[model samples]
Target chain A: MSNITNQSLSEILESIKSKKISSLELTQAYIKNIENAKKLNAFVTTTFDQALENAKKFDNKPNNEQLLSGVPLAVKDLFCTENVKTMAGSNILNNFVPSYESTVTKNLWNNGAFLLGKLNCDEFAMGSSNETSFFGNVINPIGDHLVPGGSSGGSSSALAADLTPATIGTDTGGSIRQPASFTGTVGLKPTYGLCSRWGIVAFASSLDQAGPMTKTVNDCSIMLEAMSGFDEKDSTSINKKKETYSKNLKDNIKGLKIGIPKEYRVDNMPKEIDELWEKGKKILKDLGAQLIDISLPHTKYALPTYYIVAPAEASSNLARYDGVRYGYRSQKGKDLIEMYENTRSEGFGDEVKRRILIGTYVLSSGYYDAYYLKAQKVRQLIKKDFDDSFTKVDAILTPSTPSSAFKIGEKTNDPVSMYLNDIFTVPVNLAGLPALSLPAGLDKQGYPLGLQLIGKALDEQKILNIGYAFEKNCGYKNEIKKWWS
Target chain B: MSLDKEKIKHVAKLARISVDEAKVDSLTKDLNSIFKFIEQLNELNTDKVEPLTSILNQSLRSRKDEISDGKIREKILKNSPKKNEEFFVVPKVIE
Candidate 1:
């Protein structure tokens, strides 16, 4: 069971397809792992019974042609799963079950993947650490006290702990990649319009993208193919023909130019991370790729600009949570306005409230031009910086996080400290480009460190191909002892 | 440019998320720090720069005006905290 559970998504699918193991066996193994690893708090809602039923159905009628046939996936709780409690790690929607399915998850199911459970995330996918989750913080499976980088901490932890084969998570800022880096997994933030955002809980609508988190880059490619497609429901969704990423994956880059952005070297960066970046550059060089030193001059402004843009969009998106249609409501209110105020006040976590306030202040009458408008204009300069760099290189490389995973409560209180975690990753989001973080090396303390590969807009294949080749030769593997279990 | 307690309270009210009176000072402090950090954007001059309203710079794909989705009234009213016969039930608005 452990061997079956520990296999990557591609490997698991191979075994399932060859009839070496039934879907029921695979799903049961994952369920056992999920049940045993309850201390990690990686799961917000475990659909074990439903998962077992789905596995039985898949087994009862085998569909070997499906991309993820009988492969049970536990996604970040932000995706709206029909009839399942999709809370998006907030109390406001704790009991809200959607009748309709999110296009991404629907596409996953259509491709023969079924639900395992709902993984935990930061409240409204806002916080950098999972500490802000209404359910509770997800402990890093690598070490109990260490924090799993968030807001997709649970997806990363569960993937690392073998609770799920390969999972999908929403990356707004560094949600997917940072958690994956902390847990020594691979996470990709596909181009913004590549994956439809019709049903995922909106944090920053423009920055939010659903991507794969997996133990191997091959599995990430397989899962990304399963989750992405064009949907009329999502107006921002790209109408490009569906890309066959896995089938067309190419790693033979004799002279492909990969960018090494100089601006990513921030002040006080740990020596080990700097060393890891050098190590990553060596791996790409070893893979017959040319490294060019380039600059994204506006990189420093990414974090500040994100704080304004994300919250401004968040305030507007979350306005739908008013006590009228759905979700948790306060019973203490007398009037309609009071009901809305009280419901939101009581329902949301402190981090959420702070963001809403920040968002409102920025988008308010007098401050709109000063904050929101200025941030948008700066956003253009940031995008232009990437555009200039992409002209010189096919992809860029940088350290995933400033340092390895910190303790759970280390930076929870300090907003700026937490925001700084995404400094290396947020620039990609601001520019709405595709980027992936793959584990390249470990720090002195044996915690995994990641290196990012940023590609031009709608060029996920190029990044994934580079990542696949890198993963094959990186030599860095997850030595995470199953201490939590 | 610092936000006082009164300003924090006012912003929270405008956002429709009630902040406790006692917590206003701390909230104000946090907002001010965030604001201070955001002040870095002001260092760059954008006199002729256009705001990036779109990422892909593609126009929104519009559909026909005809209703493409609907008729699931029970589903629409299912998650409501309080619901009447067909519509969501909220506190009375008019006297």
Candidate 2:
């Protein structure tokens, strides 16, 4: 019971069901852990009182009854939590609270998951590093002075620190998987419409998707089952039956064709990351899986295409945040137009402004065809690359990031360098595919290096099955020593 | 495309965001650098590819237009920074 915080979500459920530990006790343990890990800045808000209340309500319930009964889970600030401040890590929404819950979180709560609180993220889910958050960057619990890769940084750091049994994160251009990789956690970005985007603050509507970040692949599967479904509120939500991912988690991957995309190899990628990719191939190969070399020619254009499409959508989506409606407003303006300008200039962070400007410039009268339209057409090519590759393989394997986590301020000065962290991840979003990153090995600095498994559209089961096999055989350990304490 | 200060100012105006006079030069430099980086997309020949606006290519699912859920105007307006009685307050533009 003392080591309850270290248990996986499935183990916790088992413990609760056997009457070995009450739900309230587990909730208190996580609350204590979160209170002690403040220096990590993993949480923007901790709903401790409500968590205890919910745990008390489920203290006597049979755990086997509900999907995630009494599971203490954290939500990324990007998701609206009905009465809780749902800032998408921006000053503009610093005081904004939603009166409705996001469909994803609502699904979790309906399945009996208790709320641990809101986690930090990049402003409007913009940056690769958590440095763009207005509340400040979340520190990687694994090392001193390193950043937990972002937008979902707080969720990853909290899970790695054992402050929450599991957490939810939104992925747009690699927010969930990248942070999970940086923090030695497992994250799965389901197919674009697998989970509804109803109350999740929009980043790039086309790319924004919610997924599970957990300590194990098994937990990720169960959480995904509880979190995904077709919602009528979200127009883009796919009208399909929810997947029971846990039921399909098989350890055997015999004859499964895994594609190793040659385009994923970029210049100056750390030798350790490449070695981990090789190790992943060998592991799958030994598991009776055939490894095949494949090509995704439009892969290199993913980042630029993403930058264009994401910002253009972001510019349009974020235009609703005028001073009059909600959130922050500026009083310095002499007229209505000035007020709109002043409020936005003061409310948004530098990176956000930069992106909005890029979006505006691309969608401008003279440049629409060259930048926006060109990027959209290239996006089609990127998706075609995946569609062609998936025809030849069951799933694709690659390094999650070029390098492991670096110092907090290392790449802040260079915007393009920061954008490069998502090079290996953005293509999946572009194609609207499900992908997951599991810890495969540690780098030279002892930070976790993750191996990504990319699956075809609506084919998360294949990737999860492959991940289950890898998790069983990879021998990669992610247990931490509470360094943040 | 070189993003000089004037172009930066124009974009900012289009975006309805005010930039500090002192920061415009730095913003211009930043925009130019990012544009240069994105210029690599021009290297590829995409002659006949159609723009992919949606990933699913699934037809839009429309519902009969009606009030699916509402009657929460009080709750919705609760977060407004400046509100009077029933409407959000903003600086007068007509005057």
Tens-digit per-residue lDDT, B29-75, candidate 2: 87788888898899988788888878896988989988778888899
* Candidate 1 CAPRI grade: high
- Location of the lowest summed lDDT over 10 successive residues in candidate 1 chain B: B21-30
TM-scores of all candidate predictions against the true structure: 0.99, 0.99
Candidate 2's docking class is: high
Proportion of native contacts found in each model? 0.89, 0.82
Give the per-residue lDDT of model 1 (tens digit) for A297-381.
8899999999999999999999999977988999977899898899999999989998889998999999999999999999999
Give lDDT tens digits, candidate 2, residues A38-81: 99998898899998888888875545588898787988999999
- The ten-residue window of minimal lDDT in model 1 chain A covers A476-485
What lDDT does each candidate get?
A: 0.91, 0.91
- Return the clash pairs for model 1, or none: none
